[model samples]
Target: MNLDSIKQSLSLWPTELWLLFITLLGLVLASFINVVIYRLPLILRREWGETNLPEISLSWPSSHCPKCKTPLSWRHNLPLVSWLIQQGCCVKCKQKISLQYPLVELAGGSLALLIAWRFGANLSSLVYLGFALSLLALAVIDAQTQLLPDKITLPLVWAGLTWHWVFSSSQMFDQAFLGALLGYLSLWSLFWVFKLLTGREGMGYGDFKLLAAIGAWLGAPALVPVVMLASISGLLVALVLKLNAKWQGQALPFGPHLVIGCLVLLIGGQELAGWLGLGAWLEITSWAF
Candidate 1:
């Protein structure tokens, strides 16, 4: 069959099968994201000052049980499937694996399914899928390690700019570039001001970059709305954590809240606003691609 014929044949597949395919794709990607979430922080810490730590990169030190260091074979390495098969315990040491692995995979798959449903099976689906996953990974990593490596955030910022410059029909590069600048400066300014007032840093530099990436992808008009959404959601969560006995003293990470704001704007921007009676406010901000 010609390429066009193949495309037509593929497009005619039942919606269920397409959903399954998208979910599997997302699971595979999320599996790798789990690796990054676990290992990236170690790699960064080693780079910073942990000279005594063993040399390791994403490609190096192959996957293994962190507790007992047993190598995992392909059979036990499948994403959600393997987790279910193994019942969340290591084959050799019987060490319990964190529930996070399968949870992240599930989140990734569901998010992918939602994106495919929203954007359709097109190149935009692929792009936004990757973007959303990247944000998810960063959120989890930040929640755990409280560090947002420039490695991820910088690339994301640049990727957003490049996407607009190359493919975006309505979003212009100038808006993206300025969005990034304003996003970074907005948090950075707050950081310094809070520090000046209390003699302590209130947030990390990673937050500034993460917001910049969001702004870059969503545009300058999105800055205020995104921050508002992030702050509200983040503060609510923080309050909950404070009320909990165990989490009262722990520092809360803001990156995840910022990620939530970005996703909300990216996925449900106009419709969600309208539903919540923020249509006029959202329109006044003109938050759109």
Candidate 2:
């Protein structure tokens, strides 16, 4: 019942049992992520239509099989397990389902377990878990659709702020707030400058907000480096896709890079700063050179 008792029980549990639990939890979260990924766009469209724009809904009525009108049963909805058991086909219509569903669930579970192993049972652990799950959802959604829905991004911003206030110290809070402001303003400035210079949009407003959320979680000092790291990673991904002869205008999601950067930060931000000479060494090098 108590925290200590729970912790003790967890420690006493076999590694396999712990892993199974984490995997099940991850699968459940991923199942909900399917809904979020599917519905966020529609919700946004509806909101846009309500504001007087004519955008059609993504899905009307309820979630019925596209091939058959029969509703899915609880037994058919068991995340990756159900899909695996059913051979990735609908039971009613026997239509093949995309592997993305199970893959997302597996990725979510694996990432959750990894974060738990890294951070343990502290508040930081919970934050890391939430961060990983959100990133998993964001990455899948962004890859499937070029859009990064505000339904996720805005809540991520609030979650970061909430975590800082509730779990971190005043110093951490200060860093997070400053990070959010600088992160948002920095991109906004770049967008204006790039547009003015080239008559083109370099990035989206959603990216700015997402980075702000990262800032709130990581800190102000991390903003520029994270942006730089993400840019480089994004370029590499773009290059690979383009080399394979993908369209020039194909949208590349910036969310994954941010997620990767934050994960790096979570795992070893201080060490990375030292290696990159972003701290005392950088100042010394600048002065000497």
Candidate 3:
């Protein structure tokens, strides 16, 4: 077809087709997310002044069964399909796989669809899709191990600042910068205050940076609601754990709650804020840049 005809043909494509494409891309990336979640921690453990840890990396190890150490064939690594077909067992050793694999893929796929629907077919959609995936990885990592890798959260801070500078208004960029600064400072201050009073560190530096990265995206005005949501969710869960005899005294990580708070605020900002009685605060602060 000629150039004009080709352009016209592409434009004639249906919305469902675009959705399918985005969903497939998300699923493919989810496989990689699994790799990052598993290996990134090991890599970090190795790097933190440990001389004997075996070398590992996101790209070098290649996909394999963690138990068997056998490399997976292409068919064996097909996102959610492989897990289902194999009954969540390693093909070589018949080792039962963690349910995390398929769940992450599903979450990634759903996130892709949400981004496509919310932001539509545009650069913001792509940017936010990747952002969402990073948050997903962070949430899972923190929930499982209570560790948030600086490798991910640190770059997230810079990425948010860069994204705004390139694609957002100057005012928005300013908000992002302010958000990062205020985000880190606010949490850092709280952490030290708690430590001083109780002779215990209430949270980690990773949480400070995670909030800072969030601020970089949603701006300083958004910080109050984000923190409030995170605190409330975290408190509720803490209460439940404290009440349970078996789970009492378990330390809860705040990073995953922060991620959940950020996503909920991002996707349902106006409505959610109103429900939480923060709508007036959001408006007074001009929550958007």
Candidate 4:
């Protein structure tokens, strides 16, 4: 068959098949992300003198049980299925594994499916899928450890700017640059003001960087709604934790809420703006850019 005919034939495959493939790919990525979420912090801690350990890179040490350090075979490393098969325990050590493994896999699969459903087979879809996955990893890491490494956040900022410059006609590079600057400054200014008045840090510098990365992707027009949605969600979560006595007077990390907001804007920013009676504002801002 001619190349065009082959392309047409491939396109004719069922959407279900494509979605299933995306979901499986997402699960695999999630497995890797689990390793990242678990290891990146330790690696950083070691660098910062918080821990004494041999140099460990993400790729050097194969997947293994933390308690027993037994290298996992392929059967034990099959993402969610393996976890289920083992009943969330190590096959050799019988030690209970954290539910985070399966949970991250499930989230990754769900996000991938959603991206596929929304954008179909397109470059934009793949780009957004990657962004969503990064956010997922950052959210989980920050929630567990209250830290967002510059390694991920800095690369994400550059990636966003590069993506728009190369692929997007609607969003210009300057807009992304301004969005990043403003996004970082907004939170950073708030943090200092709050600290100056109350003598307590309101949020970490990592939160600022995360928002800046989001702005770089979505542009300045998106910053307000993202922050608004994030603040509301964060407040609700904090209140819930406080009521449940789970807060323990510790400040909750804001990165997850920011990730949620960024995802919301990514998936349906125009609709959200319309719902909030800010459709005109977004339109005006788009025109200005």
How many steric overlaps are in each model, in order?
A: 0, 0, 0, 0
**lDDT, candidates in the order shown:** 0.85, 0.71, 0.88, 0.86
Q: On a 0 to 100 scale, what is the lDDT of residue 227 in model 4?
A: 85
User: What digit string (tens of lDDT, one per residue) describes model 4 on residues 1-289?
Assistant: 8756755665665789878887888889989999999999889989999756767889869989999999998899998999999999999999999989999999999988988787675555667888899999999999999999998998999999898887667546777888899989999999999999999998999999999999888888888888888989999987787898545777789999999988877776587767977788888887222
lDDT of 2 by residue, 1-289 (tens): 9766765766775666665666677778877777667666667766766555433344444454546756777788887889989998888889988777788788777777776666554445556677777877776676766667777777887888787887678777787888788888988899899999999887788778888888877778777667767877888888788778657766677777877776666655566756765767434422110
Task: Pick the lDDT winner.
Answer: 3
Q: In candidate 3, residue 38 scores what lDDT?
A: 90
Give per-residue CA lDDT, model 3, range 1-289, as digits (tens). Answer: 6756654654565778867888898999988999999988888888887768769888987788889899988999999999999999999999899999999999999988877776665566667889889999999999988998899999999999999998788888999999999999999999999999999998989999999999998888889888888988999999888888898586789999999899878776677788989888878877664
Writing each residue's lDDT as its tens digit, candidate 1 over 1-289 gives 7756755665676777777888899998998899899888989999889998778888778889989999888888898998898889999998899999999999899888988777765566678889999999999999988998899999999999998988775635777888999999999999999999999999999999999998888888777667878889988998888888887476788999899888887777678657656678757755557
Worst 10 residues of 4 by lDDT: 3-12
TM-score of every candidate? 0.91, 0.81, 0.92, 0.91
lDDT of 1: 0.85
* Number of the top-ranking candidate, with TM-score as the measure: 3
Where does candidate 3 have its weakest 10-residue lDDT segment?
A: 3-12
Off by over 4 Å in 1: 1-14, 170-172
Ranking by lDDT: 3, 4, 1, 2
